[model samples]
Target: MASPHRKGSNIEGILDVKRDKVTVSPLGLDITWGGDSRYWRIDARYVELIQVCWLEVNGSVEMKHLEKSTKYKLEFKIRMKPDAFGWNDSPVYIMAMPGKKAKCIWASVDLSRIKKSEQESSLIPPRLEFTTPGPESFHEDDRMSFGLFEIWKGRWKGGLVIEGVIISRA
Candidate 1:
């Protein structure tokens, strides 16, 4: 049960989505993330899921400050621990929406395979891409919602570590 805050850590309890680009830490998520210290390790940089049956991590960002008429990518920078389990049959999905009234876009990935690939290069983690609308299409107060979900499986899973959600120009 390590504290998610430390000296010089960029992690924030509340995210300022008004920035041009930003990273939303686990602690900044808008929803209640389940798991105690025994099942989760929260530190300055990331949140490690040691074990869990239901997974639902979610967050959102304001679209006003983002570049208008531009495409943006919302991705979860994550990796799997060597002993990760329950992901073989479970495919975690990354989902996003440009505005509150917009349709949602999603993509699925296998965490077990991601772990292998990450161990190979240890460079960039996998990212899911999504495009946003121009300023003319949405109001200034509109916000884009996004998250990683793996609840349908209903099986206990573990060993997934999440750095944060990166929102950048695509």
Candidate 2:
């Protein structure tokens, strides 16, 4: 993976979200719910099958972290394995922002089709995006936040490799 974009109009490479950086919820608990940490070809050594209801990874960049007045995207870096099960019909959830009132949104991955096609995970990965405040509106502690959470859709989810999440200029 490459470093993040540093300028307003720059096209940045992937800002990888490594496995060791994940911050699981419930305090003091690890994110060993349905999957394990391992290496994959997509990116680096990361976690997988993170199907827990509160599985999350939180990260914040420094002041002027991204280019001012640029549009950036938050992507959930993951892969679909052949025996990977679940996650086809079920919707995944994500929450980003700096405060508690952040709205949760639904997301999905159709890896079943990818398995049949044997396509590279990099070709397409689930992601979310938001526009950065222009230089005028830029403020201190303006962090970009996002993560995948379990939905209350009344079923368990499994079968996905989470190499990391990335934020880059769009």
Candidate 3:
């Protein structure tokens, strides 16, 4: 079973994107803010056709607001349900944007046998470490926007239940 998705002010990560701040698909998809100020859940119960029509998930956060000098990784905490599809044999696209210093990555997901809980969510490969630029680097503002947008080769995907994007370090 998956952990109940809820929201709390203290919850961390870019997962808690304000409704007005969400720039993902507003068409053919229902993006819901999991009834909390700190959770982003897209109520994508069904996607028409499930093809390469729309294949992008985008999000971001301010580096300055995060703990200074801390190392963190951006990951989509997802638990694949039994009916999960569109994820097999398809690679996801990830990109980090910091003043044009963007790092885009490709992620392959095999959810066919994974447990159906965020606790079962595995670490994305090619672990990318993002060190907070520290407070000194911020004079005007320092925002870091990263996302899993577009499927490799324009493949469409579906049936992905997202707990949220988690920013954490070992």
Candidate 4:
């Protein structure tokens, strides 16, 4: 069973859900920014993905005066350690107007660049990563906005994680 807990103005994490071949762990995330403002930033990260799963989220806020023709950009940062076989995979998705029947739009960021090699002495890099997916139109009556990165596949030699957001503004 997947159970989610809420704290204050933020939803904490999902619990009792299956991951990595039936292993259960809480997928709690710290939402650095989210609200009814003209702009929003959503971020999250995880180190495991070994099963078929999906994250479902909805908005309880309504937007008024949102400019027509405006566009929303979604970005994601996913980091993971390579499994013993050294491989990882995930898909980022954006649902137009949260929970709508429209097809999910995949983020345009290239996954091949995710595994860039950096100097060992350099600062530690954030595992999973992304910026808001971009260049899409918005309507005045479009009150709902939400985004997510589905961990479609992940297997590697060490560890893995990713982070990113859907930023909406005029």
lDDT of each: 0.69, 0.44, 0.45, 0.30
Q: Pairing residues by index, what is the TM-score of model 4?
A: 0.36
RMSD of each: 5.1, 10.1, 9.7, 12.9
Q: Clash pairs of candidate 1?
A: none
Maximum-lDDT candidate: 1
| TM-scores, each model vs. reference | 0.78, 0.57, 0.55, 0.36
Model 4 worst lDDT run, 10 consecutive residues: 17-26
Worst 10 residues of 1 by lDDT: 116-125
Error of 3 at 50 (Å): 7.1
Tens-digit lDDT track of model 1 for 1-170: 74432222335554646455766776666322443566677775677787777777777766765766677777777777777789887988888887887889888877767744333322122556666776568666787788778889889888777777778776
Q: How would you encode candidate 4's per-residue C-alpha lDDT over 1-170 as one tens digit per residue?
A: 32232211334343221221111111333222222112122233332333223332222222232233444333333443333123334433433342232244443333334553221111112222212222253333343344343335432222223333223331
- In candidate 3, stretches whose alpha carbon ends up further than 4 angstroms from where it belongs are 1-53, 98-126, 134-136
Ranking by TM-score: 1, 2, 3, 4
Candidate 3 lDDT over 1-170, as tens digits, reads 53332222223332344422222221222232233223234343311222232455555555534565656666655555555566555656555554234344344445444555423555443464565554556422556666554444545454555545555552
Q: List ranges where model 1 is wrong by over 4 Å.
A: 1-20, 31-35, 116-127
> Candidate 4: which stretches are off by over 4 Å?
1-66, 82-94, 98-104, 107-113, 116-143, 149-160, 168-170
* Full candidate order by lDDT, most accurate first: 1, 3, 2, 4
